[model samples]
Target chain A: MDQHPTIDTRQTLETPEGTDLSLYPAGFWIRSLAYTLDWLLRIAVVVVAGIVLGASGMGQGLTLVIYFLMEWFYPVIFEVWRGGQTIGKKSLHIKVINDDGTPVTFAGSLIRNLLRVVDFLPGFYVTGIIASLCNRHFKRLGDLAAGTVVVYANSVAASPVLESVGSRPVPDGFNTDEQRFLLAFAQRSSTMSPARQAELAQVLAPAVAPGDPVLAIKQMANHIVGDRTQSAKGHLL
Target chain B: MNLEQLRIAIRPRRDWEAVDLGLRMAQQWWWPMLRVWLIITSPWLVAACVMPPEHQWLVSLCLWWCKPLFERPLLMILSQGVFGVELTTREVLRATPRLFLNQVFLSLTWRRFSFTRSMDLPVIQLEGLHGAERRDRLNVLHRIDSGPASWLTIIGVHVESFLMLACVALLGILIPEEVGAELWTWGFWGESRTGGALLILFAYIAMAVVGPLFVACGFSLYLNRRVKLEGWDIEIAFKRMAQKRGLPTVAILAIAALLQLTPPMLPSAQAQSEREAVKEEILAIKKGPDFHRMETQRVIKSTEKKEEEIDFDKGFWRALIEFLTGAGSLAAAVAGIAELLLWALVLLGIVLLILKYGSWLERFPQLLPHRRRREYRPQTLFGMEVTKESLPDDVSSAALALWQKGEQRPALALLYRASLTSLLTVGVALREGSTELECLRLAERLQQELGIPQTSIRYFSDLTRAWRRLAYGHQAPSDAEGTALCRDWAQYWPEVTRG
Candidate 1:
């Protein structure tokens, strides 16, 4: 794990398995949108339940029960049983999990949900927004107290498709990070301008001097991703 | 502009991640950003505050309309800050006029509502692009990041309002309830000049907080796009590679040698064979579990769903709806069927429970009342009265007489009943409706629990078989078996004989 200070929102958590999991905490805008969606969904559920149950004549007390359950346990049930996501969180590709990168437990979910009252203090979740802004992990009071965090469920950027160029072995003197950047360069080649691509490849001219640097760099990338057959073709050529 | 001095991680990021990176930037440099924002917007806010209550709205509108001017300075500080340049408050203030000079009129007027204003600001200010160049640059940048940039503005507006309302709500909360009620009576919401000014102040505070974040996030989005489009990370890596090797002259020589020593393309047999072998290995690896995995699972799904897109003409819809709503007969019928099925399932569950565990109740007497304390014996066994008073004083002799008179079946039944009555006395707890087989099972258990004579148990078992044959199958026992049962009964239960 590279621990040098950099401005990014990644929260790296080490699991009991001795592996580090990278979690990206969702920011205020996305969280607010999900929260609004969940609020609307809860209201719609309560209203529909009230109307349906009201017509059945056993409504008042049951409706209060529904209100109470939906208010408290709706989030708890969904977070614990539904893979740590409410419907809103699921739709937004975010989920609640233990701070240690484990699935949230029932107690954790309950404590987090129960403390939503505090997060909503002074109305409009002003306290929560402020606290999240202040914290590195964007945790509100409830998340902090419950030892949970809301994180983007899938934060891995899909590798861009690289055009097939003949493969080659990476030359000496490149460290792992630079080697990874070569792969990134090849992956993002589709997005870069042709002139920009040539410019970037020119910087690696010393390492891949015997061949076309652009072709050589992409070949190394293909080899890095386990496509080794083309290297034979390059060898024959 | 030095890649080494760039504060942010230089990897190409997804658009949302770029927005998040902007948030991190804002968080990192919040104080400087906030200071610059508050300083630039202070004069306008003060001007708004000093206005008459009725003119406050106009003043606030102008203050809001000139937000682009205030944001320009914030962006200037951020752009520098991201490159490890921490501008002092004085530097930011001094640079404010120059920052606002480029396209200020257009930014304040027609381009005010441009959703990607923050993102486009960098192109105009930092890159110094204008006219068609600026438009073309925005077009290229907007292809990937415009959605998030626009959403940043949209969400930024909502956050501003929320924070503003929260400021008012905070004030309301701090005041005691009695004072708060009085505040309403004093026109806190409407006409009070202090209240109106206070509203504008809260709105200013909200804008100040959100503005820096909005600008930073948009700037980050723009930077992230450039990173993708130009491979800044790769460039940084190349710079490091260059510095480590320290071989610019060497690289130029190598390029010259490489151009001169180019080998002509010629396919060799060895290379062809190697390619074939590699292809074979690749295919073999592709066939592994990592590539092709088969899994089986069983899932229960509802099978009764119907397609719901039945097209309805006007008259048909009316008639169908009426029929469906004819006192809700359809709904009632569905509910009725569901209720019946549920009730049937419940009843079946109860019956199955008892049938499966019925013997457990007898084995564990505490499950129900033991019923042994009553000491009340049944007067009948298999519908025959078996009381001592109902039997003859000498059961053996009476059975023997009945057998000699050709009443062999009756004689055997009398013997079986008398043995059952004796077994009850010997502590076999039988029910009133126990069959002959039940009596035999209880007697067998009694033989184990109470050290009853094995001979008597065997005799009872033999008598039960004979009696079941005579009673159920209507098959009479032979004279020898009847006489043998009568003879063995006296030995098994001498107490049953009249004393």
Candidate 2:
């Protein structure tokens, strides 16, 4: 069996920085839409309850009691069980993570929703609204208390494609061993800046071609690596 | 393996894979929206269906009157009862006028009120009435509309209007249907048909129309008295003018308590009722030409409108002496003044308590402290400046400091800036202008060039993760675990740079 390289350079090259955590700062309109939708759902729930309970004082009181329980407990239960979302939030393709990029805990979820009173401040959450507007992260008082961030749940690709090196003719200077080394180097350097790659290519060029330099080096690499297959094809060259 | 070798062997993968933590709590607005809709529509629907056809208009009007106060519960009840669904009282309570008032008050107090530049109050005022007369009416209306007095005045007005409407309805119902029809033809809807009902109906109508107006006028007089006693009118007038000029909502609300005394300061009904009968008699006779003619003739024939018959000197002098002898009046005035002072003291105390203590109570600790020193000193290895000793022992405070520092330059960059720039010089490393994402991507490339394992690259991933957490999370990295994680990553920087 062929031995795995001591250092898997290909694997290292393909790795990215951070965990590809793709979060966009949700804009005001999108947030507003979410708020609107949430309100609509709440209203629908209340309306349904009222109809079932009827208009008597006792019925109304019971309905109110039901509403209170749902409002306070629904989110708390969902967030704890499903990692921070009710049905509406899940549907919107968003999730709440703690500031440390972990799932929200029960106490955290409870406190955040409970502190909704403070966020409400003086009236229709004017304080909370202003705080949210001022904050760069789109957090309101509840989020602040909860230590959570709402992020879009979308994934991003991790690697860039490289050029194929199969078409160009081989030159006369370099041997097969040197050409293989250069191709491996070029593949690893796929994500590097063009200027950096060119600078590196300049240093290695003379070793392969001596007098003709760049042209001889390119031809030598082509012949040893079999017609510049991967590099020339622009597949991670 | 050496520590550096181990680091390389164990680095974590850093690809653009998203971790969807799920939707946030505040982002859910469905409850409030649903509550408001149910409030506005349920009562309207119920009132429509339950009331008799003829009474529908009256019921609808009453519902409209109660709409601001009753909408939420009505809707909640309707929705919940019919559909077996429920919502929070907080959601329903959010739609009331009181809630709106509280919000307006807070906003005004916070200095956030701003009226549109194009809003022209005078232009709106002019769309209806005469110049000098309209100006006087508008001034009185503005006075009644602008402050604490305005709310009291509004309540009084609504009460008076309701009473008058009830009386009219009663009288209308009492009149013979045939006579009502006859009077309808003669344009006597305002008088004959309704007026020729029982004398008691007429008397009740007279009392309803005249009594509240007299009381309102008396209250206006008392408003002036209290204004003089407490200097409230000037304060309110200043605030009103400022609000009209587009002062913030907060500032407007801040002036509400200061500009008006609570209901306890107003005149009692007994004191004001002494003058009530005279006002009622005048109003009743003024209702129709027949009554007015008869009353005027009787007054003219009996008193003869004498101009010079009475001697003012004797009457005026006698009244002055009696006023001085009236110790009861002095005591009454003093008692009223004392009561006003007491209320003023109470209100001032409340305001002071709110200002002084409310903020203090808001900062109580969030969670129990974890017994881990490493967690507390996460950034120690980076040699970054963090004044942890000076910070409050609260989690939020520590988190805030760490977050603020990390925001300026992340730990990975700090490591590069300090010692690792040389190692990165030869590979596809991050430059000064590269973004966090770009740096991570470049680090991945460097890992490849150096033959570093995917696990070893996790230092970079962790650094970026901490940086983002500090930057975006509402709470700073407060927990011991979070802080320790930051510190550990800071210490792990040398391994990240090692080829």
Candidate 3:
């Protein structure tokens, strides 16, 4: 059977430990939002520093040096030691990492930061945006040269809250993933319209016959999740 | 409407992730979407250009205001493209009129300013929803993803403007400096009609680029919201499962279950002895070479936190500056010592260079302040002596006499040795253990290096090949061929026989 391969923009890296790490490379708009936030933060700090240092004429050179360092090494310092995230990237739920899924090193961060000048070429980061758009991993020239990528940091998801339904024995022929899918379907049934919920549940009518398929699937999902308190009652039925 | 035909992976995504997926979709289908967009908007751009100079900005505004109308065809292409349906340009154009008719008034008037316009568009156009139904659909979809959809529009606006300015600035950069100065005197934008038209054109170009991308992202966000609400991925999995295992397979499975209920029997005494025998063999296999083995390694990891280099804390910079200001005289003396040390290091570098390659300077006499002549010759190469004393007084006749005595190999070896002795005497440097070919290449190089005649090098080449064939290939030369080499050897190296 020629199955349609599921297409999505995720970069999967294989570790030496024989495990697969899936990383989602963030695209242009969200990254632009992060850049804008970082830009505002930098400008505010510089302006505030200038105001404070302006009272002392000798502090002018020091202020310029401070601005220069902040402009060049702000991202490098934050990314190398701060778990591959700047203040903006942290807030946006994205961070930089080596293409091999390791933590970004100091040299990797420094090279990528320095080459931001090339990525800024032809004015306004047009080249950077185009390069990122052209590649599968959404990598700019800097990311490509440094063998790094900007991937979304994994956010832990809360366990699904299922409704209270009497537990019943699930039918055979479901693998672990399919069993999880059934649980997810039942858990998210609350958000769906009644018609849509029933329509989806009816697809498995052959497996859950002789009853309301929706209620039957929910009961099986409850049993699969190991809530067996209703087992005695379910047997009496 | 067929979920199976849907191209992208149908799964629940975060609001921003949906927008990112849309960006990827736009990049994937950029050419199809962009071609249709250019075909539709290029006419509007032409109209803007043909407009009078004063009203040019208004025409550009109209083109910008009517972007939703132009973007409908782009969405049509994407909506079909996402379902693995690629529409030709003509197909998109034919559908454009029908698309533009839906909610034309509201889209242009009030909805034009909607920050979530991209996300709202699909409900109106694709679902063909209106009035209260549309509002309710938007309400359901906006529960989570409204923030990112709004942000997308905001960022899209800024990016489009930046791209427009960038295009204009890029043109300004490409223009020759003399022409730019001439245009500068005329106040490029304020006085010239060409400048105004160009700005309007570049603005349209920027919109043409971003509009399709904005629509595609909104459509993807809408699709993602529905996938979450309806469990579309789960439903697809169920449909596939039902298709794979229908009623007949279930009956076959029931029969198999019934057959499994009855167990096969064997005589008890015989079965017990057989089972014990099998168990002993299994135990033996378990203790074999391919079975379990264990090893352990020890490693110590650091528990201390790494110190960060740049501290943004306020007091550090102040203290640094104060220390520098306080130690004025001490800083000056340290700086003076550092300057003297830097000069001494440069002098040390020159002295090291002289010690390393002083003989190389003597090779080029004109480059030196005073010449010191030098000559060098190697006594042995490839475990054979190459001095004049090693060869006979008449080298070709000695080889000819050896050849007459049926010693072909020795005759060629003597001629080859005489050639090497003459070349070394002429200062052609051949390294030790150089194969026959390497020595020939060095002798060829001596043609330019030592002004050796072409005939002598050619004779050396012929002699090296004859020697290599006799030594390595074990193929002796013919009688006439060997004699011709001996005859030419004397003419090429007559001085080789003199002590």
DockQ of each: 0.31, 0.01, 0.18
Instruction: Please identify model 3 stretches exceeding 4 Å from their true place.
Output: A1-6, A156-159, A234-237, B1-4, B181-186, B247-499
Tell me the tens digit of each residue's lDDT in model 2 across A17-115.
644443443323234335446667877887676654433445457679878977787778877898676666776655666755668888888887787
My TM-score estimates for the predictions, one after another, are: 0.69, 0.23, 0.64
- Mind giving the per-residue lDDT tens digits that candidate 1 earns over B426-484? 66777666667877887887697867899888888888898889888998888788888
Which window of 10 residues has the lowest lDDT sum in candidate 2 chain B?
A: B14-23
Question: Could you give candidate 2's per-residue lDDT for residues B212-295 as a string of tens digits?
Answer: 222222222322322222323223332333344454322222113322211111233343453464344345434523243221
- Candidate number achieving the greatest lDDT relative to the actual structure: 1
Per-residue error for B451 in candidate 3, Å, reads 83
Q: What is the TM-score of chain B alone in each candidate?
A: 0.56, 0.16, 0.49
For residues A78-186, write the lDDT of model 3, one tens digit per residue: 9999999999999999999998888999999999989989887667777778788888778889999999999889552454687777778778887787777788878
The models' CA-based lDDT, in order, is 0.76, 0.41, 0.75
Worst 10 residues of 1 chain A by lDDT: A51-60
In TM-score terms, which candidate is top? Answer: 1
DockQ-superior candidate, 1 or 2: 1
Ranking by TM-score: 1, 3, 2
Error of 2 at A68 (Å): 0.9
